[model samples]
Target: MSDTSALPRPLLEPPAPQPNPGASGPWTGLRTFATAPFRARAWKEFAYLIIVFVLGCLATAYLFVMVGGSLYLSVLVIGVPVLAAVILGGRVWGRIYRVLGTVLLNAELPEPPPFTFRPGPIGWLRSAFTDRTSWRALLFLLLEAALGMVVGYLVLMVVALTALVTVSPVLWAWKDPHNVDARGVSHHSMVQFGDYYIETWPRVLAFAAIGVLGCFLLPWLFRGVCFLHRVLAAWLLTPTRRDRALTELRESRRAAVDDATATLRRLERDLHDGTQARLVGIAMALGRAEERIATGGDAEELIAQARTSSKEALTELRELVRGIHPPALDLGLGPALETLAARCAIPVELRVLLPVRPSPAIEAIAYFSVAELLTNVVKHAAANRIWVAVLPTGSDALAVSVRDNGQGGALQPADASGEAVVAGGLSGLAQRARGVDGSLFVDSPVGGPTVVTLVLPLAGPQ
Candidate 1:
């Protein structure tokens, strides 16, 4: 059989399905936010929010009372300053609202409208006055502050009561000295327990039970408060559609620019080091050959060496060109990756299920990332088996992962040295991933299997 005909058949074939290019979906912050415990946590957040609100109000009121003595003093002198302070305070408060909203609501808040100015300091002042978002933000702050005071007061009462109830047994013991049911009475002279209404097992059991119940109920109450906080935060913080779209557009443009710059630099380097150098060496070899013709024996040997060198250089140049941009990428990532997996030293099981074609840049990154990881595995991992998978994570992203059964304890060189180390071209691979606004993580840990995962954003407004 011919050498080509004798080659082994591929273990897995690439899927025909192409991923959609213009698909998009909501950015559901984090998966943890969908859980029941997260909801419970959200409630606790509400309680904290109320507590903060109440404290703010009290502090503001106290400041007004202490610094602004009479109504006239407050209105004329202190009022303007206070109002200015409130406006400044509100701006600061908006940040707090955003943080809390993200934590509890797990939603992106609408950004305030952009500031525009006509010309000078007055222009700036007028711009601030004209800005609808600034006004809305200020209004949100004032409302939150007022509500916070009420919530804070309520929270304080609940907390105080909860604490008191929790310690009721101890207080009752101290007051009566005999554990009495001193209900509706200011001071009970004798401490009663059980039948005697003095220190007894029944009274002790009752006190213990009350303490346990209080402990259990306290957390639930706190959770309710947190829920309310989330509701308020969501209402105050969710960003407008226009703002979200603009932010996404900016991010996409930045990613594209980064990718383009990286590609240009890589292409320049390849041409300089690979093709350019090889052609120069070939020219030098040819010149040496023409000069050495007088010494026929030496000329023959040098010619043979030069001819071999030229062939090797040609091969390397072709490979360098292929590495820069594979023609198979246009066919689709699955086929490209399948070709890579088939060429590996160890057995590779590849599974690709993508219904839509991702952005060319993203697909290229994913393919190359998998290719590099597999190459590393074959060269260094010493594994018998490898698994590669590419799957759609969402409408706008795809998750690619490679796993191998080999010696573990593999870490990114930068992480291992506490400074970036250019080890085995790993840095280059990482930079390429980052260039596409993607992330790569390797988990090796000692003595076994290693898993590498890369998440690339797909085509569309992310």
Candidate 2:
């Protein structure tokens, strides 16, 4: 097999699907329906509608009873708890709907944080009363009680009507009506619509034909209402902006915690393996010096040997600590990369355009990433020049790109199956970037040039 591992992954996500270029006219509505059967997404959304509409009706009933009972009991001042319970119940519904959206609709909504308050029932009740998520959910419940149930009911009824009317001839043949027409004659095998009765073959077939067309159009109708459900659920069921920021803070804190843990783990390993061994050797040399002095022999050589080994070991440990946050990053990421370029074996063109300094953590990540990428290019690129640049990516991120005009068969550390290899070029760099919620993109096409970019956040968790 050929080495197909260097294929470029997407630089960024592509734009959303748009209407087909040639779709312009009467059948545009049904055009999408043709592909509905083959699309798993379409079916999932349609099934979601069928399931949620049932749940919506049940929720609508629950809200009605709770609200009506609360209003009636407010006279006794007991409705306070009732109303609070209602709001809390809405929060529960919010959880359920969010789950359904995630499992069924693939919603990327993050779970909201747990409510925080002082202990005791009074505090809990007070918090519930002031809870923003609960209030939004309660409003959503009220809306679902009125508009939501009605819309679902209407759509389901139309769907059933289409299916039933397609068998209208069967209905007409199976039924007998007790109503007497203007001639005082009993009507049999006929269905009434306002003032008209379908007692003949022509009317039956005409309605059946309309039903058939509706069957083809049902997917669109189902999808439209499902889209509305998704919109409303996303708005009410998902966390608020404050909730999102809190979630991000928690996540960033988690990433920081994990990074610290890894650093400590590495430090422990180094102390146990390398530092400990070196210290033992130094201690042995010092003991030799002590013996030589006691024997009236020259001890200077042994003492000097111990001293040099001790200094080297101490330097190694210091470097390990300094590696945690590079000292060069204190001058900012741009200048750090400039220093890196100066040290590279290949001639380089460097561009730095950072309006504001990023958080120290970000600067450290960018500096080391460029440094490693530069080393990789020098090792494998076989090229004359490397181009490195730092540019602001929107308001929140900084992008650092390294392009090499080399023999461009640089593969990101991936195996033949495209699974990431842990110990290869670009793989380690990719993992290093991801530790800070950053990403690495490689565009190496095997002939001339390779462009690798790193997108780093400007600020820490906010």
Candidate 3:
């Protein structure tokens, strides 16, 4: 049986219509070709194609010279360093191609795993020889060079031909003897089609119209070629799916262990410094009061001290309990978040719209994720306003977002080893979220708004 009891009332209302980019009307193709040459996207892609073309040529030339010479000299021991250099160069170039493809082609390729080298020249040689990634990169460089030369030449010819034909009326020199007949009268050859000579002025105008049409079609055609190049790059540049999955699993396990350790240490410190210390003070006060009473000396002051110590201890214990699980959560996630917003250092606009209650474990994770994000904003982001929202991402997951309008340059930068530097408190929060199979994303550029989002499965920590 299916459960519908938890569904929200808002689900009954119709959702607003969203425009589908892929859905096309009768004039869609016409409109695309008409606007292709003028759109910024087309220009950006053209620029990207140009860059790929240039880099491909350079990579091919360099690798052919260096790698070929090294292979030829392999009998000599000196060739070892040269071979290592080729492999190293290929790896670096592969990374550059990956970055470019990501930005230009919008291809989301998983990063190749980091290479580990042992001590000494022999180790370096062995690693270089065994590195499949570097060799694949070298192969890609060779392929890209051939592909780029052909595609680049074709694109250049198309553009140049289009420009010449389109501007023939303005730029064609009729006074030149070659353009004129033996009679020395005005004459020029027009671009030809099959069985058609566009030699007359009227035909030349028609040829210009054809050129205009070609200009519009070329950009879209180039885009198709670029997509094919992206496919080739993905196959050659990224690690295999199995390898990527293993890497992610290892990282997740490490993060889970680290997060648990940090949490336990924090709890222990809080207990030792706050509640435990207060309890010890209370015990000493009570002991002193008992001594005063038994000795028949002034006991009033000692008794009063005991009462004060007890109150302080009780306060510390309440605070400690709250740290473990906020008391506000007893009322449910929405109300708890509202209570949290009320205590924020900066003004927070909170919104929560969930169709059903998430599992308690998921709820706890969501709560702490929000709390940590808000704390980060208060500490690092000098902001005047914050907005926190919790809503269902789908039937299976909920998304919580905390956004602040502050100076935003808060990101976990990658180290030299290409791993994200996870030493900061914010990185710890991300790891904690990851422990539950939830994901955290931070989008904070310099000088402004920072938005952090955490998404958790509705079924809880899976």
Candidate 4:
């Protein structure tokens, strides 16, 4: 009989999107460390540390055994120098470990103390000895060495035990070896099973199974030791708060520089297109008017030339002013983009979905990006159809995209090509789009179709 109540029921609505906690900073580091490749690389480093530690311990033990109590005298003579060397070595090792850990674990490590101008190598060595981090790393190394020794002994013991157990039946059957009884007695005979002796195949199979089980557990035991190594590494390799802050500051500065360069290029392009071009046109018109009067042409002809030149100058001046700041943008990006799309040579489809207008700066960048993208499409793309989409991206930004169905292959060359060329008209547009803290990316193949996307920060209505 079917039980309707026992069956699971579907929800009426889809579940809301869960927030990603590890997408930002430090948590991201931890998440990266947990991935398979990073974990494997960390284990490789741990293995190398174990090897170095074992060698160091062996050397130390050899020196101690040879000198005995006189080792104290040797320490008094060489102890200071050895300690200094170990500390210096630790500093160097710590720096290398820091770089490796950052790459593998994506976590920052404590910054090494600033270097000072020391008189000689000895002075520099003394400074390294005084550094607290150097001492800590040395202590860590020593602990690792001790732990490695213990683990090595345990591994040997397990191997020996497994070997002995696996061979016990053979030893008893072939050599007739004496064995310990439950009572305080030694016997040279083997126990008999039903139809066979205990030292037979059945007993041998039992011992082999136990040995195989122990062998299988060996990797788990090694993993536990490796986990301890990870703990030590995490403690000694994580960066100090100050270093992390400095790193963030450097990244921010780089982003700002890129933004500034983009802005400068946009300003340069506007000056060239607006003020410079207008001045040039005015100069040409005035030259023609002067030539007409100087040639002793009729008064009506000269007057007519003057009037045409004056009208052209006025038009150029208005265009120059518009280039500096377009009034279309004040109407909002939707209307501005609509006006742009209407002017495109190719058919354009624009999609805009936003409840509120973005900031003026964001709008300007978006508008210019779309304008440049359409210009490229009309000039070189040979596109029959174009699509532009604008939408609010989450709560913090606006997204804009232009797509075209044309012969693609629009990538900028390494030296100079396509829209990225310095002399290319679209270069100014690309620069304008990059200004005002926006990113531009193009995906175009050789056959057909191209898509350009831009993302800009959105503050609020101007």
RMSD of candidates 1 onward, in order? 12.6, 6.6, 9.7, 12.6
lDDT of 2 at 254: 67
Which structure among the candidates has the greatest TM-score? 2
Tens-place lDDT digits, model 4, residues 1-462 = 111112211111122346776567866755553353335654454454455456547634633543343434445866555555555556565665556446544444556544453678678667756766666666655665566566655655775787666666776678886546556466553543443345446776686678766654554555566556556656764545565555545554565577668767876786687656656665665677678668975456545655665676577666655655567998999999999989888889989877778888777767766877788788878889998988766777776877888887665342543233212443344444444444455556555566666666687321
Tally clashing residue pairs in candidate 3: 0
Error of 4 at 369 (Å): 4.3
Clashes of each: 26, 0, 0, 3
- Candidate lDDT values, in order: 0.62, 0.74, 0.75, 0.61
| Candidate 3 local lDDT, residue 74 | 80
Best-fitting candidate, measured by lDDT? 3
C-alpha TM-score for every candidate? 0.52, 0.71, 0.58, 0.48
lDDT of 2 at 212: 80
Worst 10 residues of 1 by lDDT: 1-10
Tens-digit lDDT track for model 3 on 1-462?
Answer: 111223321211222356897777889988877888998767767777788788877877788788888887787989878878788777888898888878877788767888877789789888888888888888888888877767876886787898787887655446322244445654456444544545666877777888888888888877887887788889998997766766767787898787678778987998898878877887887888789889988878867877887888788778778877888888789998998899899999988889998887788888887887788788878999999988887799987888889987665344576443222655666666666677676666566576677778888665
Give stretches of model 2 more than 4 Å off. Answer: 1-53, 67-85, 99-110, 114-118, 173-200, 268-295, 314-318, 325-335, 338-349, 354-361, 372-387, 393-397, 403-452, 455-462
For 1-462, candidate 1 gives per-residue lDDT tens digits of 111112221111112245665443353433333343346664545546664665567546644653344433546764544443443444456676677566554646654544446787556555545555555565565566666676666766776775665666676567765333446443332333344542454665565576566655555555565566556655655455666556555665676677679878987887798778877877887778788775653667667777887888788777766877887887899999989988888989988889998987787778777877887887767789999888877677777878889875454233755442224445455555555565555556556576666767787224
Q: How do the candidates rank by lDDT, highest first?
A: 3, 2, 1, 4
lDDT of 1: 0.62
Measured on C-alpha atoms, candidate 4 has an lDDT of 0.61
The candidate, 2 or 3, that scores higher on TM-score is: 2
Note the residue pairs that clash in candidate 3.
none
TM-score of 4: 0.48
